[model samples]
Target: MTIAAAAPVMLCAWLPTAPGAATATAALAGVAALALALWQMLRRLGVPDPDRAAALILLLPSVALNGVIGAHDTLWAAILLLALVAALDRRHDAMLGWAGLAIGLNPQAGLTAPLFVALLINRRVPLLRWPIAPLAAAAALLGTGSVGWTIGLRPLLHEAITGHLLAIDAPNIWTIVQTLPLGYPLLGLAIAIAIGTIATVIAHFAARPIGDHDMIAAALLCTMLAAGLLPLMHERAFFLADILSLALALVRRDRAHWRIALLVQAGSTLALLGHASGIDALTILGGGMTIAATALLAGPLLRPAANDNPVIARSA
Candidate 1:
């Protein structure tokens, strides 16, 4: 509850006179911020068509669904992008500060924060007192527990996993499985967590220097795995994953990669618009589209980067 509403509430605080105004502001600000970040990141990566590529986010159907339809989830993507930029610049304090806020923003993004922090620590960021990165980094932990305390852990856990949707409207493994003759919601949830875990482990080992494709690809895997499979998810679930996929595509500057980004996002759109318009076929087809598109994406992206650190590289 805290994670999901943190961004919206913060925005509302600024526009205290009218929450409607805040929602309007959040929608525009989140996508605008994300687009700018993508543009800058592309310029840094030396993509020839950075301008064209960065504008891609503006055209995604899911953007209209979430941003125009009053969903605040885009803020999660924006904050992570800011935090990633900070990490790339070695501004560890800023990174932690954004990361902490991200942990308080969305569960999929928050779930990836610990893994990101763990990878940062593994990179020998040295908790030495020269910079207060550790102190700054504690932001991820500090304010994140308030919601759990308020709601009680058991209820929170139930809300997160067990007590939620058995038939998610979005695509991925669970949607595919649950739509079968006999749905296994618990089993599907277990498999989703396992997929996310595998992605997390791969990301832990594949931690490249901040600027490399490995870093973004690894991060993409961490978030996409969960957004794709977890039970509390819906059409908007793939929001971060869609952004990351496009980012990875832009970083690589491959036409095929761009197509991959387009397709997965198209799937998200299918589910979103379908549900909104009451088109069940589009939703189901969107699920299949998501499954097919992500399958093509995950296989290539999930490969471990060549060893740069023995501690992470070695199998235990």
Candidate 2:
């Protein structure tokens, strides 16, 4: 809560007269920043057409929902993109800083931290420099004081442990299995760890030096894994994965990838709309779309690399 509170405080300071205005303004700014970051990442990845890339990003339903709803997720999306840009640029300090801010805002951000670490390792970055994220998170903790942890971390952990945080309301596998006689928390944690490990290995071996494609692919995989396997994930948790998939589709210009992106967007949109309308059927359809999209994308992402394609190779 303390970390998420930073957005409102920062935005409201500039628009004291209207808190709603501040939130809307922040969401707009976050959307713009996210587009810019995506553009930069696509360029860095050697996309043939920048305009198409921008269109693809702007057209994503998840992006549109976040922008219009003025959810804090818009800001988190921007932060994640900026961190990806920093990693692509080989700016280790900047990557760590953005990632730290992400972690401060939501512990879920830690799920993607290993992708950055993989990037650093692929580039042979010093192990000593890796501590920057933890240090920055500690600094955020110190700045917030003990009250932050007491109010924030405790509840978050409790929700996670008891399966209270499961994405049963979302169109996800959890929704299907939730009613079954099983130990949910343990099952969810085991699945998350297993999938996360596979994603990390794929990220490490797929691209030497870790290009934008590799980073984005790894992020998409990890985000999907988290959303599908975490005990208490929300449907909105797939927003990052949806965005990354769109970006990947645009960059790769592959028909199949583009189709996968469309599936993700459709699924996310249905889930969001269904949740709003209290329609369980629509929610199930949405979750099925997500599962299909993730499955389709996993093949290309997890396939053994023939060689590091230099065109999409990392500058670092």
Candidate 3:
């Protein structure tokens, strides 16, 4: 297990030896980190009403499940990545540290770190720092020196390839996928995710020399697409996407963004409800809302922008 998951176990050293006490402590820490990260990212994005906007994420069922109701490390993993994004915006040296920690916590962050690095690299932070995340992930995931490669990321990769289910109340495209052989649906899901990811990258780079707001918007879109496309997903998979919707709304402070945020929160909540109650109707509706939210999330990036690529970026 990664440090994030092992935290509650380790907390036994400082707190009561009971599993419940340690778990509560760890969950509290994750919630606190999440709260602070939401505020800092919103402030850095220049949200005029950070307090009010921060409250919006609390309404997301995924966030509530991961941060309060469960002792899940996914919340901490996401906050660390959010901190890394904030560090890049501030041109701080802590970017690598945060990236390393986030990726260490959740190997999934390894997929998103490089893009953030590419966005903010200049003479200030430079391009050299961009390679560390992948290298660290490779060493942990592929290197023979470690056991993590065998038991950790390997299982995740296996699941991604041969999904255990069509959809676990995730309310995504796969939810609509008819019951078929695992190979066929997993193959289709992979292709769809690849195409969506490519489009997301295009949308991101089209706003190249991307601004902080642009980054937030792109993160919102990308996370939504991931939640909506990936197979074998659960309601909690929308955790980051649901939270980023609020962050994007705050950054834009507009009707459309707010609408999407509200829709995403509601959809994720419904998905969670369906998961708990075994109601396919609720999940189907939630999936529809999720898909709509993702489509709207990409709208802004689809718009025209000035010089996405600066052939000769300004000197620091």
Candidate 4:
């Protein structure tokens, strides 16, 4: 969390442009805030030596990658994970509020909102607490950004609000639809695939609270696959989705999900290699399908296990 939030700030100090500097600085501040939140959460959880070790092992590579590649959106991604960790453990309503605000600040963090709502179907949180943190976070980001870029900030922020959906890097079913001409035969098939994936996620969330995490994990994975399996996806969009899948696997302590997660990770790694080594499309798509199938299958299998085992909830 600290690394994801901090590295960008560190990088901005050396960059030459003003807009880049402002963006980087805001990201840094957001990351720093997230780090503090994570620390407070760890303390609340009674941070053990093992927890610290595990966090370090997991986060170091993440931080390094974001820093090296200058992946700006990752700071918000870390915030979403921290919120998930807190929420999964049944933490206070304050954490959910923070997660929501983080979502408003960066739409990528919106993933936490649906996950939390799914959690709320079976869990309890005060309603008032729901709006405060998100409102405050939105106010802060907008107020701060306005100080730097005045006249047209509203329009710019509005663009930023929905930017995640518009970005070509979105690895969802639309990617495939985007590949086809408006009336192409594959367009209908792509729509069906998207509806099915979304319906599966919703059904899983609706059926059992035990599978909330798995639902979120599967949704993200499917979104990524739907994004990448499309003929048009670039490689980098798979990165954060893959990370979230791995984390979900760890949280569930399910080997099957882990295997699926690894397959996706391996596919991403191979895709990166393909980009670097100029590998053939046949090989790339073949590997991608394997990864996509494994990830896509993981949710249903793991979700059912959670519903079947009441003992798992007690342990968590």
TM-score of every model?
A: 0.74, 0.78, 0.74, 0.59
Local error of candidate 1 at residue 168 (angstroms): 2.8
lDDT of 1 by residue, 6-103 (tens): 34434432454455666687677677666776776666556678889889888767777786677666666676776666665666666666665654
> Taking the tens digit of each residue's C-alpha lDDT, what string does model 4 give over 1-316?
4344334433443444677665556455544544453443344434444244235323534333444444454455555555655665666464565565455435444433444654555465567666665675676367436444332234336644554332233333343334345654454464466456544554555455553344446445444544443333444445556655555555455786667666656655555545545654423553555456455555354446664654223332
Best by TM-score: 2
Candidate 2: residue pairs that collide = 165-231, 165-232, 166-231, 166-232, 171-287
User: Which is better, 2 or 3, measured by TM-score?
Assistant: 2
Candidates sorted by lDDT, best first: 2, 1, 3, 4
CA RMSD of all predictions: 6.5, 5.1, 6.0, 6.6
Error of 1 at 8 (Å): 12
Q: Candidate 1: how many backbone clashes? A: 1
Task: Summarize candidate 3's per-residue lDDT along 1-316 as a digit string, tens digits.
Answer: 1234334322422453366665666566665556657776776666777777766655656766764555344443544545445553664445564565456555555444435544554324566766665564454344322322132355456766675576777877677663335445364655677566755665445344655666666666656665576566666667666667777777777898889988888888888888788888788888888888878776656545444322212211
Candidate 1: misplaced stretches above 4 Å?
1-13, 49-52, 114-118, 126-164, 183-196, 199-211, 304-316
Q: Count the backbone clashes (under 3 Å) in each candidate.
A: 1, 5, 0, 4
